[model samples]
Target: MNILFYNDSQDQLFHISPRQRRVALAVALIMAFLTLAALFFAGTKLPVMSAFFPVLGAWGVMGDVLTSFILFNQFRSSRIFPLLLLACTFLLTGILSLFYLLSLTGMLPLSGLFASGSQTAVWLWCFWHSCFPLGILLFMGSLHFNKKIIDRRLLPRYLFSGTTAVLLIGVLLLALATAGQDKLPVLIEDGNYRRLIETAVGPAIWALCALASVCSVFPYKKRGVLRVWLSVAVFAFLLGVTLSLAAGERYTLGWYGARIDSLIASTVVLLSIISEVNKLFVRLRRQHEELEESQQALESANEQLKELSGIDSLTRIANRRKFDEVLKQELNAPQRAKEHLSLLMIDIDFFKAYNDHYGHLGGDMVLRSVAPRLEAEALAHFGFTARYGGEEFAIILPGHSELEAEQIAELMLESVRSLAIPHQYSDVSDQITISIGGCTLRPGEKSNAHDFIGRADEALYRAKHEGRARFVFANSARDSCLHPFETTSH
Candidate 1:
């Protein structure tokens, strides 16, 4: 039923849920038992059961019409050729069934329309059964045609106009051909005549049925629920035809069995459609959850990338860019205007000589060893440390005066000396040491990151000039530079 709505081009059978699979198995087993029982007792007929034939026929008509509506709606949404054909087939079958049912009940306005129990009704009956199979054959044959031939924008118009024309033509021909011909020779009177008619019409219906079965197989070659059920539908159709032939008389037990077979065959596709719909909803929900999870994972990865961008790759600390950004933010921040902030400039003394003697690789190890100590001391003092450039690092301490900044710098100096990294090429003690320059100020509207950094750099130069292993303070007053006792240490 949903074969027309199928979007997958891979020629595989449609999937179904476990629950649907179980339902299909139950339906198949019941249908199989019904077919066997009907065949086993072909001659026996209960008048009560036979009386309900009309009711069952009415139900079959309604089912086909409803199924047609569903298929047509699907056709409108998907614009698939197979869906359109199936919808039309069901609709036409429903109409034909109505005509046949009206004749059986003697309610048709056209009394000449193959009047009940008449010879012409036999021919019409055979023709009615053949109509749906022919439509199925047409659908199967056209599957290989170019899809572009049916323009979607004009499809509804074509369908309406084309079906109208065909219906009108068929009605006109049926009326004209059968007019005044109700009294024709008996179609089933003589055994030879019956055999002749059967031989002539039987092959045509069987050939169409065979072709339809072939078509069903072509679409779903892969093993799956849809393929299994579709094959069952086609087999049921063939079995119904067989039962009709074996009945050998109208209104017999075999005839009722044939009708039951037709009903089951027609409904198999509809049952599959319902099952497939449930599975589709389940799959869509799973896919939606997966999509949401993937989006969240992507957001998390992007945040990690953003953080990495602001960090130095070698030392895994805040880089120069991060330091510059923070310095600008601190200088302009209104909340910190009256609050003391200090910048410390620390340089590894004789780093170039150290790199040359120990090689750049060993110098990189010494730099990595020294950075964590500096970062820990700055962080403990409620500050952030960054690698300002090669051989130099800067710490930004908010709410820290010059005296408090000096203490933080002392801790960092001690932390580096504690490492006691050997430096054979140093002019100072044969271990790594850093010169510290400390600058403290209360930021104002006029304060800039460049000037703040320049004062610290100048202090650092002063510290290096005096001796390479001591701390100096750059006074904010333009005329004054202070040395914190110049406690030089190695």
Candidate 2:
């Protein structure tokens, strides 16, 4: 039922659409221009060759195209889109690497120079250097959007743990790559060997990033600021690695310049992915919260309904329905143990005539007053009481003998008499009074609840017939009999 998904931090940054795509394109274009201008200016000022610029521009454009495709696809579907995008991206990278290798070894003459042994080294340096700033930008952008993308998927806990581990490894790898580049002279001779070593750094870092991307497919229940922080960490590590490799010194003048441009384009693409991820995470979180709230509401409603179903609306006591249930439970145990069980049926005397005189409202007040007295007295001697019907109430006394039940009935009569409520048109005395009929099931009495109730009803009839405001005990003998008496009428 819930439609909105959000993260713990309440950040809603990732939502890729045509508008975002346009923005990304605009940013990519701007970065591309900046990279080109930097390359041209550097070439004019420094003794950098012009031939490598074209190759650098080509790689930059290709990287931008591939990244755009991947970013757009991710918004459409997480299940197949990311995988397809990654596959296409990896293929493009591989092709670019092959082309670069060909250009370096003199088999390809795109630059119009037999790539001198030095030229190949220079090309590697140029490629990474150009890519450095762009990679950092892309990584930052991805970090910004990681939350959205994470929200879109049900990532597993282990995947998040693995991502953290991979992110850590990426950080270490970046550090190592930077150290290697900084100590380029000691690590390798300043030629093609150094360039090859630098190239290895990018692929190694990319492998770590790829692992992280794959892990995103698994469910990770992480939320809030933690997701943001994790994303930032991964992006930073990747950015550091990319920049380290791209900013190295041992490249051909033209080749070095071109790599810088390509790096900028790649960076933009990665940033797009991050933005998408963030939006997805936000949506997921909102949905989760809504679902939890709905479930709680449903449970509370069910509990209330259960309570309402068991309670009597009139007197706020357990109704006849509840009485039946309680009786069944008590009877089962008492019957098994052959224990004595007593039932008292009490009714307001002359209730019909009282209603005729004072109206239903006054009668209701009288009933409410009389009902609680019966309940209190029953609970004092017996165990439970219930409003059995209009103007009628019942109490269950477990393990009570016939004599004990009669005593309890007497107590109920006394309690009702103490209320001092007036009843003018009664056939009994001048005050409000009640008639109670009680019957006790002796040990080994093999009858259902109906028989016990029938006997109590008979005794109540006898109490009313003799006079109101008295207690009547139903005889357990075969013949219908009752010892009834009036205690106090007023």
List the global CA lDDT of all models.
Answer: 0.70, 0.55
**Candidate 2: residue 149 Cα off by (Å):** 91
TM-score for every candidate vs. truth? 0.51, 0.35
**Candidate 2 per-residue C-alpha lDDT over 39-146 given as tens digits, one digit per residue, 9 for 90 to 100:** 433323244554565565456546545653553344334422223233233333424343444544445433322322334433433343323333333433443454
Candidate topping TM-score: 1
**What RMSD, rounded to one decimal, does every model reach?**
20.3, 20.0
| Candidate 2 local Cα displacement, residue 167, angstroms | 93
- Residue ranges of candidate 2 with Cα displaced over 4 Å: 1-309, 334-338, 476-490
Q: lDDT tens digits, residues 1-490, model 1? A: 3353235442123654566556656766776677677877764543545456578778777877777777777666656676577678777777676666665566655544533444444455555577777776665555556343356798879679646754664464345325533544344653122442455566667566767766666644343554456556766776677666666566667677888877776677677767667778999999999999989996896577447658887787889988987788777777676788899999999999998888999989987998988998887887888998998999999888877787777777777887989988877667898988888885453567888899999999988897777678897333222232345432
Residue 268's lDDT in candidate 1: 76
